[model samples]
Target chain A: AQSVAQPEDQVNVAEGNPLTVKCTYSVSGNPYLFWYVQYPNRGLQFLLKYITGDNLVKGSYGFEAEFNKSQTSFHLKKPSALVSDSALYFCAVRDMGSGNTPLVFGKGTRLSVIA
Target chain B: SAVISQKPSRDICQRGTSLTIQCQVDSQVTMMFWYRQQPGQSLTLIATANQGSEATYESGFVIDKFPISRPNLTFSTLTVSNMSPEDSSIYLCSVVPGQGAVGYTFGSGTRLTVV
Candidate 1:
């Protein structure tokens, strides 16, 4: 079984400041980690993913995530937050060994970029 | 990346009525999935919509209540039967463009409100 945990339900950050949303996972095998954003009344947009190779992965809308194997974490980050960037962020994971398995998503973290 | 178009962006239905959500992909995809996102909650995989085969549902979800149809590789539908207030949620369809793809593309969700 594989599962993802987003420790924070909501994160507040000032505009122009760095923002971080924490995510961690548990899986039997290597994990394929992903981050997605959902704006109000809209579908989810893919942000980035960590399958193999580099520990740091950059994504859409100036967002990035660091995949730390030792910590079992893939935390989303933005160098400078923007008010427009506020949205519901989700962290998902699928077992790389489990062929074509559906992704398991973490309870979403709502990010609020305060101006 | 594949583009998906989902219909019935939002709907208000009477209890006991059914709603069918449709998704059409621009490109052929190997894996398609349906997910439910309850208010302020994480996404839950409803089923894997297999082309030309019965959908494989996750635990706590039954085929009778949530019937799925994937007649071909580019299209799929999910019908919510005997709708109730508990069934009010955002339904989303996702697809993997090809095997070993790092990210999956999602459609604009269908929001169902049962009254």
Candidate 2:
């Protein structure tokens, strides 16, 4: 079974500083990785995905993730964090073998960009 | 991108009763899925809603407990039957519009609180 791990339950970062939310995945085959954000009382919004391409995948709202294949990690990052960026971040993975497989999400990391 | 409209964004239901949540997507999709997110938790896929056939449920979820319906390519429903406080969760609907591993779009979600 494919699974993802978000080690940090909460990451506290000062606004305007760089931020990183760690994510590692385990899959039998190549992994399809994604990052999603959830605001208060809202559903998850897709940020970015790594299907097959460059190691660094850019996503919406100035977010980017590095897909490290050897390390089996897809970490979300931002150059400068904003106060509005404080939200729950989830890392998800699905097996590349099948298109119909549902994504397996990590426990989630609560990003706190303190202003 | 596919847009989904989920009905009854928030609802309070009595225990032992049932509540059905509906998701309507703007475009035709090949795959639809139902997920449950308990408070302070990530997401657990409940089932895959396949059109014109019975839904494929994940482990620890049953058809009698959470019946799903996918009447068409753009619509799906999930019902939490004989609900309890433990069943209180945010139910989300997801769709794969492109039928590929690129990504998926999610509905806003239905927050159900059993009392």
Candidate 3:
């Protein structure tokens, strides 16, 4: 079985400042991790993913995530937060060894970037 | 990434009624998944639909209450059966185009409000 956790329900950051949303996972096999953002009245947009290769991966909208194997974490980060970045972020994970396994999601972290 | 079209975008239904949300993908996808997101909450996997098989539902979800259909690779539907006020939520559909796809493409989501 695979599961994900986002410890914080909300993260507040100032515009132009850095922001980090934490995520952790528990999986028996290698994990395929992903980050998605849901803006108001819009579908979720893919942010980034960490499947293999580099531990750090860059994604759309200048967002990035670091895959920490030791910590079992894949935290989403942005160098400079913007007011537009205020939205709900979700971290998902699936077991790589399980063919077409459905992704399990965390509780999510709501990001609020103030002007 | 696959482009998904889902609708009715938002609906308000009377209690004990039902609503069927459809998802059409631009490209062929072997698996389609249905998820539910409550207001101000995270997402939860409801089921996985394959073209020729019945949907495999996650724990706490049942096929009778949330029937799914996948008659082809690019199209699927999920019906909210005998809905009650508690069934109001944002229902989303997602799919992976093929192998080597790291992240799932999601539909804009259907906001169902059971009154």
TM-score of each: 0.98, 0.98, 0.97
Candidate 2 structure quality by residue, lDDT tens digits, A48-79:
99999799999999999999999999999999
Residues forming the 10-long window of minimal summed lDDT in candidate 3 chain A: A96-105
- Alpha-carbon shift of residue A111 in model 3 (angstroms): 0.6
Tens-digit lDDT track for model 1 on A23-65?
Answer: 9999999999999999998999999999999999999989999
> What TM-scores result for chain A when each predicted structure is judged separately against the true chain A?
0.99, 0.98, 0.98
- Put down candidate 3 lDDT per residue, B35-94, tens digits, no spaces: 999988889989999999888998999999999999999999999999999999999999
Retained true contacts (fraction), each candidate: 0.90, 0.90, 0.90
lDDT of 3 by residue, A4-88 (tens): 9999999999999999999999999899999999999988888988999999999999999999999999999999999999999
Give the clashing pairs for model 2: none
lDDT of 3 at B68: 96
Residue B93, model 3: lDDT of 95
Question: Against the true two-chain complex, what DockQ does each candidate achieve?
Answer: 0.87, 0.89, 0.86
lDDT (Cα, tens digit) per residue for candidate 2, span B38-61: 999999999998888999999999
- Score each candidate by Cα lDDT: 0.94, 0.94, 0.93
Candidate 3: docking tier: high
